[model samples]
Target chain A: MSDEDFQEPEVLLPLDAWHRAHGARMVPFAGYSMPIQYEGIIAEHLWTRESAGLFDVSHMGQLLVSGEGADAALEALLPGDIKGLREGRMRYSLLLSDEGGILDDLMVTRRADDFYLVVNGATKIDDIAHIHEHLPEELTLNHMDEQALLALQGPKAVDALARLVPGVEALSFMTAGAFAIAGVPAWISRSGYTGEDGFEISIPAEAAEQVATLLADQPEVKPIGLGARDSLRLEAGLPLYGHDLDPETTPISADLGFAISKRRREEGGFPGAQRILAERAAGSAFKRVGLIIEGRQPVREGAVVQPDGKITSGGFSPSLQKPIAMAYVPAVSAVPGSTIAIEQRGKIFTGTVTPMPFLPHRYHRQGSSK
Target chain B: MSLYFTKDHEWISVEGTSATVGITDYAQSQLGDVVFVEVPAAGTAVEKGKEAAVVESVKAASDVYAPVSGEVIEGNAALEADPALVNTAPEGEGWFFKLTLSNPSELDGLMDADAYKTFVDGL
Candidate 1:
C-alpha cells in the first residue's frame, strides 16, 4: 500500500522526486514513502558489501538538546552518561521505559555547542514525547525536522566521502563533525549499520537533492534501496527496531550493554537500570544470536526456532552467499556453534547460532594515543 | 518451435524431445536482483506444475516450478555466484535448465508467449 494510505500522517523526503527518477520502487515505511529497491535488492546488497551503496535515510529524526540543565535532564531519561561525553564525540545509547525495557536506541552526539541526537524514524514522535515529559524544565529539545540524512556505506565509502567532504577523513569510527560537502554545510559521522567504513551525512533538506545527485555520479556509489539496506544490516549483525529490538527486549538481553556507560551502571539513575544492570550481572534468560542457515532456503521473520527460540530478523545475505538470520533463544542455546532448527512453511531448516557479524566489521578506528 | 509458460512465470521453448527453460522477463523484473537459484539436479524426474527449483531475491524467496513433466538434463550453475545473470538476460544466457520432455502434449495446456504477456499485463 502507498504511504498515503497509512492511518498516521505521512512525511515525504525532499529527494522523493530524485528517488522516483532513479527507478526506485517506492514502498510505505514508517509513515513515509521510501525506496524499497532500485535495480534489485540482491545487486544493491552485493554492491554495498563489495563497493559502496548510497541510502536516503532522511526520514530518521534529528534533534538538538540544549540549555543549562541539558546533561542532567538527559541523564534522567537515558541510561547513557551524557554528562561525561566529550565534545564532538558521539555515543550510542538507548531510551528506556519506567519498567526498564528499551523504548528506542539512538545516537547522541556532543556538538561543539549542543547535544545533537539521531533517532529511529518510526519511534521519533514517541521518543520526543518521552524526553519532553521526563526532562527537567531548564532543558529544551528542538526537533530538527528540517534536515535530511544519507548513509554512504561499504568499503569504498570513506574514500568517496573524503573527496566530497575533505575533513571527514580525519574522523574515527563513531565520531562526528561538521563540514561542508560540495560547498553545502553538513554534519558527517563515521558510522553506519552496514558493518563497513562509511559516513552518515546530515544536510539541510534543501541541499539533499544536490548532494544525492553528486554522490550518485561517483562510479563507486550506487543508489541502494531499503530492501538491500535491511539485508546489509542483517549481515552486519545490526538489529531492526520493531523486529529485533522491541519494548520487551532490554539492552542487556539484546547484547547492547556496551551502549550503557560505566558511570551510569554504577550510579543507577536511568529507567530500568536496576533490572538492566542486574541482568548484566546475573545474565539474561534469552539472548539474541546470529544464524547461518544450512541450505539455500531462507528462514524468514516470525519463523519458529525450535526446540525453543524465535527468528527476529532473517533474509539471504548476499555477502555471505547464504541465508542468514537473527534469533532470540534460551541463553544456553544462543552460544556460537549451537545447532538450531528453524521452521519455515511446514519444513524444518537446520541452522547454527554463529557469532554476530557473520562478516567482519570494517570500522575505521583511530590509532591509540599511548 | 513453440513457446509455453507456467502460471509460476517459468517459460519453456520446446524443440521436439528437448526444451529450454527459464523465467519470463516479467518474472525476473518482478524478482529484482536475483541472488540465488537452487537449480534442480540434472536427471531428476520433475512432474508438470510441481515445485522444482527456487529463485531468491534480496527481499523474498520464490519457488520455480516445472512447466511440464520432464527429466532435467542440464541446469545452469553460474547463477550460484552471479545471480544477476537472470536480471540481465532472463530469456537468453539466463536460461534456468534444460529438460528432456516426457509428456510433449502437456505443453498444449501451457500459455503461449502472447497469452502469458496478457496474463502478466492483467496482473
Candidate 2:
C-alpha cells in the first residue's frame, strides 16, 4: 500500500515549515514530504484555472550544464533541438534510451553561458547518473541543490508577479531569464506545467521562504499543492513521468514526438533515432490517448482497457466536470472519437478516445494571452 | 432507536431491524469535493467491515465499508447524480444505504455518539 519510492527516508523541502504552517496535508511523494492538499484539490484546481495558484515544486532536479560542446553532448543523449536552442528560450524535451524508449522528460533552457535543465524529482538521481555517463568529458553538470523552485500559475499570475518583479511580463511563453523578486536573486521562466499563463521561479534555498511569503501575500495567489498540480496538468493533457511515462514507453507511443525537433529528425544521430524516428514515420504499436468517461463514476489507473493494456492515469476532471484519463491502447483503437470499454471492480465503464488537453491551453505569448 | 458508530467512521441508525448507514461528517470533510459515489446494488449481501461502496474525489478514491452484516435493501441513488451530498450532508441525505440487520447483536460492539466523537478527536 506504500507507493513511496523508498530510495531514502522522506526528506523536507526548504518550504516544509512554510507549508506546514499554512495547513497543508503533507504526504510522502518521490522521497520527499510534499503537500498533497491544503484547502482541497478541487478548489485549488479551480482557483488556478481562474486566478493564480502558487506551487512548491522544489523537489524537481535543477542542474546547470556547461563547458564546450554541452549542447551537442545533450543532443546525443536527448531528442531535442538543443544545439539550436536560442538564448533565454526553453524547450521541452525527452531523455531517451538507445532503443528510443523514454528515459525521462525534461525542460532544457539555453542560458547565456550554459544550459539549465529541470527534470522530474523522482528520477533526478538516475538522470544525473545517465547524463554523467554520456555527457562529453569537456562538459560539467552541476546539481543546483541549494535552489528551490516555485510556480505562480493562472490567468492573473502575470499581473500579480509583475508587481513584485518588474519587466517579467515582457517574457513570452516558454522563455527563461533572470529576475530579482522582492530583491532576491532568482531565475524565472515564463513557463509552467499547468498550461496557464505562469512563471516558474528558482531562488536560493535561504531566500525561498521570504520570496514564497511575498508571492503568497499577493491578492491573486493562493498556495496550491501537488493534488491540484496533478489535476491541473491532467486538464492540460501533460503526462507525469512515473505514471503516464516510463522507461518502457517510447516517445512515439507516449505522443511526445514534438520533443523530437525538426532538425534532429533530419540529422538522425541522437540516441535511439533509428527506432524512434522509425516509429514516428510508421506509427508505434500503441498510442497514448485521452478518455472521456461516460458517467459520474471514475475509472482509475490500473483498470483494464478491453482488448488491450491499462489506464496509466485517471481521475475526476474538475475542469470538465467528468472523469478524464490517459491510457495506452492498440494503434487501431486510438481514434479520437472511438469509444472504448474499460472494466474496473467487476463493472464496465464506457469511455471515448478523445483528443488530449480536455481543456484548451491559455498560455501567454508575446502577442496575446487570451 | 439508537445511532451506533463503527471504527471505520460509518454511522448506523438502527430502528428495530432496519438500519440507515452512512459515513460520518469527518470522513467526508477529509475526502473533500466528492465527485462520484459507487454503491453496492440493492439486494446484495454485505458483511461487516467489508467493502460496500466507493467515494471518489478529484485527488483520490476511497472504499466505504459496511458497518454491519446485512442484506442491502436500498442504495442512495441520489448520490449517483449528486455525490457532493457526502460533503454537504454526510449523515443525513448522504446516507449510502438501508440494510436489514442479520445479527442485531453486532450493534453492541459499536460505539455510542459520545464515544464516537472522542474517537474521531483522537484521529
Candidate 3:
C-alpha cells in the first residue's frame, strides 16, 4: 500500500473551526485534530492558574450505561464502588484488565436515570468494546458522540460560570447537575483534570460553538489549548492515560489505589480483583513517584532513572517554574525525600522524590477554606 | 561577517574562521517558548548535519543540528539561566555556541539570507 493509503485521516473536533480562527496550533492527538496551544503554552497555563481558561475537550468519550443491573455490571469491569455512588456524585475509576493491568482511567458520575462516564479519548473505543463483552446483555451502553465536552478551569472559573449558569457554584467538586447556559441544555460537573476549582460542561455538538463563544466572552475566561491543559494537569500531578497509566500498569503500581473503593476492595468482585488485592496487601514491586529535577533542563518521557526506573510523564512545570516528572521506581526509592539520578542523552541529572501535586491542588471542595 | 542558513533552521554568522550559531527567527517562532537549551562545550568537535545541541520548549525537546563541521569555542551561558532568550532575540543574543569552522568550504552548501527566507516561505 502507498504511504497515503497507510495514513489515517484525523478526526476533527466540533470546535475545529473555532480553535483555528482563534490562533490555535493544531496537532493530531488521540486521532483528532486538536489544538495544542494558542498564544503559548506557558502563558496559557499561567492564565488558567490566575483566571479562567476554557478548554475544548470534545475529543473525550462521553458514555451512558443504563439497565436493571448497570451498577453491578460496571463494578465488575471497574474497581470503584459503582453501586454505592449517589446521584450527582462522581468518582475517579480505573478499567482493569483480567491481569490487573489498567485499560484506562476514567470519571464516573451517577445521573438521575443512567450512569454518565467520561473515558480517555484514545482508549474509548476499546473501553466500549470491553464493557460490551463483559456487561450483561440486558444493559444498554450508549456512546454520546454528539455531546461536546468543555472544561472551564482555574481559580476564577466559578465566578465566570456562575454568572452564566447561576446554580453552578452550588455544585461542589466531584458533583454534577443538569443546567442551562444561555438556554442551551448542559450537564455541568464541578470537576476537571486540572487540580483547580473548575467545571466540565457537556453540551450538544451543534450548540458547542455558541456555548464556547459565550464562555470566552466572559472577562475572566480565555481559550486554552491542549498544551496548557497538559502542563496544568502535570503540575496538578494528575496522570495522563497513555503516559502515566497504560495496559502494563495497575492501579496499585500507578499509585492510584484510592480509585479502588473501600467496598470494592473488601468485596473483591471486580476484574483482576485477586491480583490487585494481593498487590494492595503485599505492595507492588514498582511504584509511581513524583520527581523534582534540580536543574533547568527538563527530563522528558523515556528518560531512564538510574538503577531501573523510567519517566512516564515528564515536563517543565509552568506553575513551579521547574522541571517535574512522574516515574516508576522501586518501592524503596519512592519516598518523598529520596534522591534519584536520571540519565538522558548520556547525561545524569539529579532529582528528589517529591510529594505531588508539584504545586498544591486548589480544588474547591465542600466545607474547605478557600 | 557573512550570514548563512541551513534547511534545519540553524543560522551561522561567519567572521573570519570564528562563527556564532543560533536557530533562525522562524525556527524560534516555530519552537514557541524555549524553557531549556543544552549547547556543546568549548573544544568539542561537531560534524555537519549532526546533533550538537538540544532546545527544549514547554512541549518537547528538539535537536539543534550543527550547520557545518566545527570546533566549538563557547556555548551561550545566557541560555543556562534564561532560555527564553531564544524566543526574544533568537538571532541577536540567543546564539547557542561559537565555533572555529574546520571546513569553510562547506559554507558553499548552505543558503544565504534571501535564499533561506524563500526556503522557509516554501515550507
Best by lDDT: 3
Write the residue-wise lDDT of candidate 2 on B1-123 in tens digits.
Answer: 899988788899999999999998888877778999888888999898889888888877888888899999999999988999998999999999999999999888999999999998976
Q: Rank the candidates by lDDT, best first.
A: 3, 2, 1
Residues A1-370 of candidate 2 have per-residue lDDT tens digits of 0112224345889999999999998888889989889998999999999999999999999999999999989999988899999999999999989888788899999999999999999999999999999888889999999999999999999989999999999999999899999789999999999989899999999999999999999999999999999989988999999889998999999999998899999999988899988899999999999999998878888999998878989999988899999999999999999989999988899999998789999898868734
Candidate 3: count of backbone clashes, pairs at least 3 residues apart or interchain: 0
Could you tell me the lDDT of residue B24 within candidate 1?
84
Judge the docking of candidate 1 as incorrect, acceptable, medium or high: acceptable
**Clashing residue pairs, candidate 2?**
none
Clash pairs, model 1 backbone: A100-A272
> Could you say which candidate leads in TM-score?
3
lDDT digits (tens) for residues A1-370 of candidate 1: 0012334236688989999999997888888999989987877888998889999999899999998878888888888989998887888888899777889989999987689999999999999998988877778889999999999998888778777777678888888898998889999998988888889999999999999999988889999999988988898899989889999999988989888888998999999988998899999999999999987767888999888779999888887778899999899897889899888768799889899888898888888231
Ranking by TM-score: 3, 2, 1
Model 2: lDDT equals 0.91
Q: What is the CAPRI rating of model 3's predicted complex? A: medium
The structural similarity of chain B in model 3 to the true chain B, as TM-score, is: 0.99
Per-candidate DockQ vs. reference: 0.28, 0.52, 0.49
**What tens digits encode model 3's per-residue C-alpha lDDT throughout A218-262?**
999999989899999988899999999998999999999999999
